[model samples]
Target chain A: MRLGRRFVIAVPTLWLLLFFMVPFLVVLKISLAEPRIAIPPYSPLWEWVNGSLKFNINLENYSYMWEDSLYLNAYLSSIKIAAIATLLTLLAGYPMAYYIARSPEPRRSILLLLVVLPFWTSFLLRVYAWIGILKTNGILNAVLLWAGIIDEPLVIMQTDVAVYIGIVYTYLPFLILPLYANLVKLDDTLLEASRDLGASRMSSFFRITLPLSMPGIIAGSMLVFIPVLGEYVIPALLGGPDTLMIGKVLWNEYFSNRDWPVASAVAIVMLVIMMIPIMILRRAQARGAEI
Target chain B: MSEHILAAETKPWVKGTDRPFVRIKGITKMFGDLAAVKDVSLDIYRGELFCLLGGSGCGKSTLLRMLAGFETPTGGAIEIDGQDMTGVPANMRPTNMMFQSYALFPHMSVEKNVAYGLRREGVPKGEAMQRTADMLGLVKLDGFARRKPHQLSGGQQQRVALARALVKQPKLLLLDEPLGALDKKLREETQFELIRIQEELGVTFIVVTHDQEEAMTLSTRIGVMDAGRIVQVGEPREIYETPNSRFVADFIGSVNIFDGEVDVAAPDLMRVNTSEGPVMCEPVAGLTARQKLHIAVRPERIRLSRTPLEAANTMQGVVTEVAYMGNLSVYRVQLPNGQCLKVTAANGLHEDNPITWDETVHIGWSAAACRVLVK
Candidate 1:
């Protein structure tokens, strides 16, 4: 039985090592090498010289990233944008998820289906559709003018606000799904017990419901924040030039500028920065399971 | 009002000077097409441990929820300490409920769970802490105050739930199968502890349970429920010995009911002409001749013997089955008329292998042991 259990776990561990760790090691090696104006676009970290191994390591790509404010600002802005979008998604998704969970059984499945309905369309196409709605003469502005709520068209496209709206809209289901799972499993008796113990409706919500659903909140936030941190399509289609993000910078560095080593260095730094929240999420999940 | 006072004086637990702590008048709760609790009126005295006993889906829990203010009655009113609670929410009502699952907050420590009610009431931290400590001590869980609910055993978690509900010292405490999660042994032990704690605190308790033994042992009074209506309300012994209907008699314990028509109705005795035999029972007022009725005799009340005894209420039967329980033996006797009667006898030390299967026996009971039910 123990051997079979070990074999079961070993298969997935071996697969992760080959598919994920090996590629990550390759990226790390490239990040330590210097960029070259050649076909491969980067120097090898080790070379054969006079029958002995010679090292050709370069710290210049990493140094250059620190020296340039553009890369630093891109990293900071990506973090900031992802954090704000995660907060917005949480604020919008909590009530939606709570209502869906509390809905009658027949209606609950339909509400959950509505939450995941956006996934039927391509994510890129959805972001593009937002462009038509958020543009100066778009559907939103046209509707406001037609309804006499505004006299002129509102300029919403190609801005940070538009980028935020796009990220929140696209990642909303990611946040709500986990939250709904947690909220639906909550015992209704707990709420009634809280009320029986003299807690008002709002107080009972804070004292019992909020604390119990913290795991879901953390899981949902990580789902949105991790992907939005490296979000490329939404910002590329809806953000203006001022919306500097690390994913966009990495794309420009590797595809447009052809600096593979620098781009690899940027990727390495992003992974290190994201490790904090990923570790926090694992710890929270473990604690939730323990409870 | 004077009549109410006079009636209250008759009850052992209720003094004539003290008013009913909870007065429910014709309260009915309907769910779409189903009436969960049909128009039920009951009066529970202060310091009385009243139990609502019924089978599953019998609306005992629904009545308890209505008393706790979780469910609004479709009609009538509930008065607690002379205050009308028709529209009052659960939080504002002077009642606390210990759930069947013992809904202790998993995230909170034992002390914190106990202090939650006082905190919601905006009590000062010092007093709340003191009271929480006192309540934990009362439940004998003071040593485990820092532990979370999951860290405790089922019985310990039950104590935490009890402490949390009682720390607020509400006018009434509602327990919905509070010992349902515990094992049989722990449940019996907790039943006594619950009664002790209830008496110590002097808080009116309304416990809902499906276990007849628990209700009999823990409650000062038991309200037996069937379908959606209360069938009888009295002390546990009265409910057990003198059930008003066949439903109550069959639900409370093992019984052999004889469906019959009233053959003779005298001022002193009544005779019921059952298919098996004519049953003589103690006279019940208002029972006329030819009226359809049932004669219910508890299993333990019937006497069994190998030889026929000349008795007023006796029948000859062959023992079909004998189940030897630890303290008692249950004998299923088959009569010549094809009717099966259940007889339970205590296993005395000298009566080993007493009356084996297929043995002819005489089954008898006193007239007072038989309860006549018209419903």
Candidate 2:
């Protein structure tokens, strides 16, 4: 390669190596070590004993994670929750994005601003506020009870329902922003032409609008799904003891249990699990670009 | 009104059916405070390639959209195939439109795009596929069925759009500037292709275009619109040769217009006094002596010569500008009164008649060539 092209390519590759690959290598190294009560809190994978070199690569942490039912349950439930939340976000975001894209001029800009306006406040504070709204005898239940819609105050707080609500409310903007950008570039005439060709309004949307917005849907799904899979914040606050997520498991293993080696093993496994969807979405996006 | 009768007499389709295939009665459309189409009424015969010709925002497109059921008229009615189309949506209407943008579905293959309408109508899959293939063959895009819209050229995309619209075999086909996207040579070919397809299917076609030459060559009749109102409707030849008003004459093609007044009025012959001199023209009804009106003479009708002819409508002018096109030569002759007249003479390769710049010439046209426009 030419010097200029090589230099242009080296920048991002160098940054990724320094920040991502190096840190990941460190985690891999730690995941192979045994727990120690001494200073650094983990036995080294290699060290010189007396004159000769001693090697001790512990596979105990990984074996324990594979054997434990809690870890298995956490991984399964995390995937399910992420998939369901991503779908809910897509269904809720698609219409808002479509409406904003079709709106005229200043109103379009205003609606887009409103979609992103929630980003201005602190995310932690917003999720904390959901606690007040979703708890028993809270605002939602209070309103429902007063309106005679419910016989009792619902036990929504510390449940999967509250967790889903929290995740959707926080991550919805992530989906809408990309979907809106895609929908906005769609030509209005394509839809009109569909109708002109004897397709009804519903038929036109599926045949025209939905297929054209596939790239946006895939992108937004990845943006929400990838992060929600490892999400620790919402579930920790709004979910009960019955809720099983890999993020909370990794957190408990790392901080409360003081088991760095096991935590590193859990982190490496989570990283591997997350990579599968990322690869799939990337391939889908590339195919969409070809079309 | 007489032009309508004149147009109707020459058309076999109009004579075959006493009623028009599509009838628009006082249809008007308003956008906020601005009226886009206003109280325009027209009748289009079956199998006739009708063109709504106008400048930008002259309501030609608005009227076409109303026919396709894309836009609802603010007032009045539209009847197609003897059914009133007041509240019908575009999908349910017996009409299909080819948009000016050639809005081919970017994701779908050409065959799928063509088969979309049939699929919507619950046609059998095998029959829909057959019709799609046939439509593609009709548009000469048989080899391009598997390609996406973006993979095709602009002309090919236009053909795909045409095939997709025509696959359903609509009673009325609305084309919004059908040839506006193609190059001149391609447009000429497609114009005939479109006419051939329309003739083969015997479907009524209504095209909206601003290019007058395209309208003249492609449409059986042209409706000239201006400022939200249709100024006149007639056959292409009638629109060009006997335009009813000054606006129609000026809008259709180049013409030398003179503001004149009636010196004598009769059914057979009339003499009009103009700033240049006295002008004799064919009969113009409802004219009194000394009444004001405009007279128009087409550039091609006028004869240019070095020597003056003993003609009834002859004027002497200096050739200020000369443009020699390959087949014809056009001269802009300036009269003594500062009124300029344009005359086009065909260049016969064998003849040695040459008229040039700064040459004193006499421009003349017969009385029959002159047209009297009331407004």
Candidate 3:
């Protein structure tokens, strides 16, 4: 029975190594592969001529990254945009989470369901809906003009601001759910104790509630951030050509220019940058788990 | 102005003489249609450890919450130190509550938890630290100040919670099953420790517990609650020895209770016609004649002997089972009238060893041994 149990566990372990671990090794090998712009539009694995083996290796792709200013700019812009989007999501979602968590049982379940219902619909459909709402002749500007609040339709869509809005709206549920889960499990007596100790409502929020919700906040921010770093679809749909995100640049390299090695380098650099916060968040979650 | 005051005039502080330290008057709490606490009035004097004893859903915790300002009374008021606290929030109330779960902040260390309330009050860092140290010492947890709540054992965590609640020094301290988390031996030890601390600080404590032994051991006075109302309130001895109602008699301890009619009533004693036969009971004052009453006799008060005794009252019974505890033996005896009587024999050096199972025995008790109860 024990050997059968061991086999049950080892099967999934072996499958993961083959599918996940082996593909990463392939990617690593391709990352070091030589890039030659030729007829087939691909690098040859080896050059075998006159029955002799020749190991041709170069660091040209990595050195090329150092000289490319656009790659650097794309990397910097992605970081800045992801940070702002995360901040906006946190500001908007924390209070909504608190309200949901503190609501009466019947209302709490209904509100949570409503928040999560958006996710069940197609992700592409939600972004497409945003486009109609945020365009120059969109619902927002049209309503404002009808109300006589605006003289003309304002240019609201296809801007960095539009990109930010798309990111925030897309990931708001991811941020709020974890925050609500953590806040609901919080000891309400601690708040009462703080008040009895002499803190006003506002002070208690900053001192107790905010600090204690750090782990959830970090988890939520990372969840929104990691995907937004590599996000190409929303930015492509909402941002102008000047947006200069790494995802857009990487897409241009792969499909438009057919430069796989540079695209792979961009992918690798983005993954590395994203891993920093993810590692920190995993550490935080581990600490919370210890508790 | 003081010189011009009349001789009949009293100072503002001296004006209130008879008000209780904490008074709850006509307070009612309703959850939808079910009344959790209904029009309950109580006066808890300063330095008194009052216990609200009841079974689950008895509304004891609700009353304690009202005193702590956590729950607003649907009607009437709660006052502490003669101040009206009807609309006051729990944080603003001059009271603190020790929750049944202890509810210690898991993220904070013992010192931090104890100092949290004082720091909220804008006390300086140095002063908060000093006071925190003092509180930790009061709970005998001075060395464990740096440890988190989960690091401490259950008993230590309980002490930490107690210190945290008492550090604020509120006018009243409400405890909801304060010792419920501890083991039996630790609970008993903490019960006496709680009394000693309360007496030393001279602070009023209103404890809510479903444990009868906890209430009896720690309370100067106990209020026994059933449903949402207080059924009776008296000292533990008074509640046990001379319970006014059958409910009180049955709730406080194990008793041999019988439904009976009051056949005769006198100043000192009364005769009751019980199913087991005619039994005489000691009369409690204010009982009238022909009252439908119940009679209670404690198991330990009855005596058993092998030889049949020539007495005014005796029951011929057979011992069905005998449980020999280390200190005492419990005998379940069946009488000729088809009633089971529980008799306890104290174990001392060869001290009154009880009869074995299936042995024929005669049981008797004095008239004063049983109490006449009116439900």
Candidate 4:
């Protein structure tokens, strides 16, 4: 290759190698190091006290991770919450996407703009805005009390429901954009042909519209489900201690207990657990394209 | 009020046995401020192939859509088998449409697409399959039942669309520019195939097309539309030989038209005075004294000879150009007044001694061959 082309290609590759790959290798190395009481807990380096090479490495961290019941429970809970949230987002996004796709030309642009305008603000700030509304003393409770629907404030704060609401609100645009792309490409004449062929409007939707839009459904579910698996901020703020999410557990191990080896082990397992759906999503996307 | 007038006129025009199968009454459709079909009334009889012929944006497709119940008329009623279908949805109505694009289901097989309507009507699976197979056999697509739409050729796809529509046994079938997407040869072949199918099934068909030849070849009767209103409706021969107006004459076929003034109006015939010369026409309705009229003469009717013929209504002209097709020849003749008229002749023994271009020729037609078009 030419010198200029080599420079253009090699620069970002070198940057990634130094910044991204080096950090992951460092983490992996530290995860395999033995537990020792250094100034920074579980430092991989060993000191020669008796003038001999004092190298110590063990698989105790992996053994502990495998034996711990809490780690297993955290992984299972993460999957369940992400699955439920993905389903909820799909239920909410599908109709909104269809309506946007079916709206008049002038109104379709405005509706799509409104669906995406929430992204102008910071994602963390948006989640915080939801916090203000979903908390026990938030707008939801204030409205219920003012309307005399409830005598007391509802205990919505620091619960899994609030966490789910926070996640769905933040990722709604992600779910809707994909579904809209698929729904808008559908030919309206197909529905008319179906009706002309003696199928009712409702039957046409199920047999034609719904099946043809499955690729969008799978795509939107993946977009919401994958990131929400490792969600920390929403659960940390909204979920009580009783909420034993994997992200929270990993966070506790790394910061409060200062157990670096155990934290690294949990991080590796979480990475592996997250890769399952990613692989499944990749397969679905390939099949969707083929269809 | 109009029905009484139509019925009163119908008694003398056509007998009771020739009653129309489908009657469209005063159907006017308006989209906001624009009128798509304006006070259109037509009678399509049983087992007759009819065509709504026009150019784009002429509301021919809109009229077909209204017949299929895809668009409801702003005023008027559509009746199939003597039953009103004013507010009926397309699914509930006994009418089917063969779309212009042949909107076959991309996911379903041919057999499944044909069986869709029967299944929707709650027919048992075995009966539906039998009917679907029968329909496939009728359309000559029996062996291709397992193929999806995309797997078939354009002509085959059109046949699948036809079979799917006919499987329901609708009272009336509406085809919106059928065979439009096929090649020229395929379109011609499909046109004949469609006519044969309609004949065999004895079903009423209303075909919409912008191609004048397709309409002329396929329709038993045709309604020529312009600017959202039908200008004239008649049998194919009448539409070609005797159009009601200049617009219908020019739209249906190529003709040599002469703008003239009525010189005389007799009981059986009318005389018109044109810049080229005076000509005679068969007497038609809606004529007034000294009114401006258009005279249409078909290219084939004007006989050309090298020598001046001793005949009535003869014109002396020079051959300007000659277009030679394999079996026929068209001579463009320019009269003394600088008016050009076309004369088409079939190649035969006369072609062995044909007239060359730029030769002086005499063109004449019989008086009964021309129609006085009141435009």
Candidate 5:
């Protein structure tokens, strides 16, 4: 019995140690080091000098990030974009989740399957496909132009709007799945009780269903917000030159400038910035369990 | 407000002077081809605690749901307080329901839950707060107003649900298995608490439960349903003592029933020839001499002794098994013809007079004690 219990506990511990803790420690060590023109491109933490041990820890990377306004602007812009994208996803996904949750048996399963069906394709390919549909000469513009809806080709191909579309389209399932799970577990009698207590349908939704589904909302928002904060691909591919994100800046520092230390510093700061919402999501989940 | 809408007197059902507070006329609900509630009609008077009693899936809950407007009747009309309820949504209706699961809002405090309806009605904050506090006090949850539903025990949550439902002062209060979630001890106590509150408030209540004992203790009138139809509806004593059908007699309590045909029918008595022997039953109106029927008798009414007593019905049987309860002892006596019967005898305080197992004994009852069920 003891051996079996230990084995069950050891599996997840070992998995996290190997995959998560080690990689994070590596990044932390690199963030504290100085850039060098070498194979690994960063100075080691310690070196043998004058037959004794000597330390070479650099705080210059972090100070450089603080001195420049580029990093601060990128972080703020990323938060703004991520917050707006999350709001849009919520507005679109809540109704879909409620519809699926309220739908009767086989139809409910079919709707849930449709929500997750887009995930079967490659994420990158799906984002790339958004480009094909949203560009100036793409299907959307062609159809709108043919229908006399627009006299000129709308410049929506390379913009923040296109980026929002890509993020919501890609991460929609994340929001819907959790919200559906939460809404499905919500007892129908609670809604009935609300209605029976003289609440209008809209009032019932706002009072009962919305408050009960807060855990799902916070969880999905954190899942989308943290990833979209340091997201490099969608903004880099679809956003114009004015669109500056921390992930793109980090990438440019690592590959173009060969500055692994500064890149690691930027990555660490992004992680710190994302931790606040993730902690909030965790507290919400804890409270949900109590409920 | 609800009192103004209600008619006068507590036992209005007995006088038959005022119109029924709730009139369900031929209400039927169908789920595809199967009918959950098929043409059920009943009248509930003001200040009456009526119970819809049935086994599971017998449509008692469905009938209550229809009254609450949770499920619209497919082919009938309901008139509550002299107004037609067709096309009236659950929110618009002047009825509130206490669900079996209690359905307390897990996110809100007890005070907030009780105040929710009044807030929706746009009551002033001070008035709503006063009413909410009064309701919480009525349900004996005055100190736990700020606690959420999960923070309290099951019984406390149930009280919160009741306070929330009653704070609206609805014309009709529908409860679906209110005590089904509680344990035996709490259920018995809550049953009387429920009665006290109903009588004090003088509101018409329709409670749905499968427990016959609960129905007997809580309701002024009980409607026994079977197969999506109400088989019988009457006062508790009337339903128990003079059931019109075999289903109601068997469903209500422990009963020993014997199938038989009427050999002779007289004004005061009827002789039934059963597989065991000829049994005596009370004469029921419209029962023919040769009509096939069943003789039903309660166990406590039957007498068991070493010698036969002077009664209209008597049978000789051997006591096969005996179960000694504290107050009463149950005897499983088998007749010579291979039929077993349950007979219970209360243990007298200073008596050692119980026929042992495997002994020849006689069971007899008066003709009036056994009912004659034709169908």
Candidate 6:
């Protein structure tokens, strides 16, 4: 039985080592090498010198990332934007998930389907559609003008606000789905027990419902924050030039600047920065499972 | 008439001077087109362990929820401790419920779950902690206070739920099938523990349960419900011995009911002409001659003997089934009229010479043992 279980686990372990670990090793190796003007665009980690192998590791790429204000600002702004977007998504998704979870069984499935309906269209198409809605002469401005709510067109497109809107809209289902699963599993009688014990509706929600759904909050926040930290398409399509993000900088370096070594360094550093939350999420999930 | 009046008035708790602590007046709860709890009125006195006993979908739980203020009555009013509870929210009500599932907060420790009510009442933290400790000690769960609910055993979790509900010191404590989750042995043990805590705290308790034995053991008075209506409300022994209807008799315990007509309805004694034979029973007032009625006799009340006895209500029957329970032996006696009557005999020192199946037996019961149901 143990051997059969080991065999069952071995397949996925081998696949992950080959597909994920190997690529990560390659990226790490490239990040330690110097950028070149050749086709491959980066120097090899080891080279033949006088018929003997000599290592050519470069620390300049790492130091250059620290020296540049653009890279530092991009990292900080990416973190800030992702954090804000995650918070917004949580604020919007919690009530949606709670309502769906509390709804009658027949309506619950339909509400969940509505949450996931946006995924039927391509993510890029949805982000592109935001452009038509948020632009100065777009649908939102046209509606506001027609309604007499505003006289001037709103300058929302190609701004930080647009990026935030796009991120929240795109990742809302990811947040709501996990939260819904968690909230639906909550025993209704626990809330009643709280109320029965003299807790008002608000206090019961905070003390019982909120604390019980912490695992879901952590899971959902990580789902939104990790992806938004590396979000490229939403910012590229909706954000202005002033809206600096690490994903956009990495894209410019690898694709436009053709600096694969510096881009690899950026990718490695992003991974390191994301490692903290990922570990925290994993620990929380483990603890939740134990409970 | 005098015996009836004495029986009604002699119950010490039902005196004229005693006012009910909780009065539910003509309360009706309707769910869409369905009346889950019909027009029902009941009075429960202070410090009484009252049980709402019924089967599933019989509205006992609905009545308990109405008492907890979780469900509002479509009509009628509730007054607790002389205060109107109409439209009062569950949080605002002076009552707490221990849920059937024991709904202890999974995220909190036992201490926190117990202290949650006091915390919500804005009690001081130190005082709340002290009360929580005292409640845990009352339930004998003091050492397990720091552990989360999932970490405790089922019985321990039930105790925690009890402690949590009781710590608020609410005027009324509602328990919905509190022992339903425990195994048989644990359930029996916890039933007494619950009664002990209830008495010690002097809290008025309204427990809802479908388990008749649980109700019998725990309740000072039981309100038997059926199909959204309360059929009878009395002490457990009164309910068992003098059930108002066949439904109450059957619902509470094993009963042998005989459909019959009143052969004679006199002031002193009445006789029922059943399919088996004519049965003489104690007179029930307002029963007229030749009127259709039913006679309910408990299994334990019927006597089983191998030899015939010259008794007023005696029948010769062959024992078809003999179940040798450790404490008692149940015999299914099939009379010549094709009716089967259940009789339970105490299995004392005569275990070796037990009554076997197919043995002809004489079954009899005193006239006082039989309940004459007019409905």
Alpha-carbon runs more than 4 Å astray in model 5: B1-11
TM-score of 6: 0.94
Ranking by DockQ: 1, 5, 6, 2, 4, 3
lDDT of 6 at B244: 92
Candidate 3 per-residue C-alpha lDDT over A140-219 given as tens digits, one digit per residue, 9 for 90 to 100: 99899999998989886889989999999999999999999888988887776666665678887887788788889999
The DockQ of each candidate is 0.89, 0.76, 0.59, 0.62, 0.87, 0.85
lDDT of 2 at A61: 96
lDDT of 4: 0.87
Interface RMSD of each: 0.7, 1.0, 2.0, 1.1, 0.6, 0.7
Pick out the ten consecutive residues of candidate 4 chain A with the lowest summed lDDT: A38-47
**lDDT tens readout by residue for model 3, B126-230:** 998999899888889979989988888999989988998898887888898999989999999999999988988878899999999999999878999988988
- What level of docking quality does candidate 2 show? medium
Write the residue-wise lDDT of candidate 1 on B186-228 in tens digits.
Answer: 9989888998999899998999999999999998899999888
- C-alpha lDDT of candidate 2 relative to the true structure: 0.92
Fraction of native contacts (fnat) of each candidate: 0.93, 0.88, 0.56, 0.72, 0.91, 0.93
Q: State candidate 5's TM-score.
A: 0.96
lDDT of 4 by residue, A38-78 (tens): 76678654568678877667678889987989988998899
Cα lDDT tens digits for candidate 4, B53-164: 9999999999999988899899999998888988899999888999998888777888988898899899999999999999999989879989878889999999999999
Q: A1-291, model 1: which lDDT tens digit per residue?
A: 999999999999999999999999999999999889998999999999999999998988899999999999999999999999999999999999999999999899999999999999898888889999999989999999999999988878889999999999999999999999999999999999999888889988998999999999999999999989999988899999989999999999999999999999999999999998899899999998987
lDDT of 5 by residue, B94-191 (tens): 89999999898899998998999999999999999999999998999888989988899999989998988999898899999999999999999999
For model 4, the stretches where C-alpha displacement exceeds 4 angstroms are A1-31, A34-60, B1-19, B265-269, B283-289, B349-356
TM-score of chain B of 3: 0.91
Off by over 4 Å in 2: A1-18, A45-59, B1-17, B263-271, B350-353
Off by over 4 Å in 3: A1-23, B1-18, B266-268, B284-290, B308-313, B351-353
Question: Model 6, residue A171: what's the lDDT?
Answer: 96
lDDT tens readout by residue for model 6, B1-375:
888778656443667468889999999999999999899999988988999999999998988898898998999899999999988899999999999999988888889889998988999999999999988999998799789888999999989988888888989999999999999999999989988888888999999999999999999999999999999999998999889998998898999999999988877778899999899999988777889989998999899888887666899999999898889989999999999999998888856677888999888898988888876
Candidate 4 lDDT at B51 equals 94
- After the best TM-score superposition of candidate 1, give how far the Cα of residue B105 lies from its true spot, in angstroms: 0.6
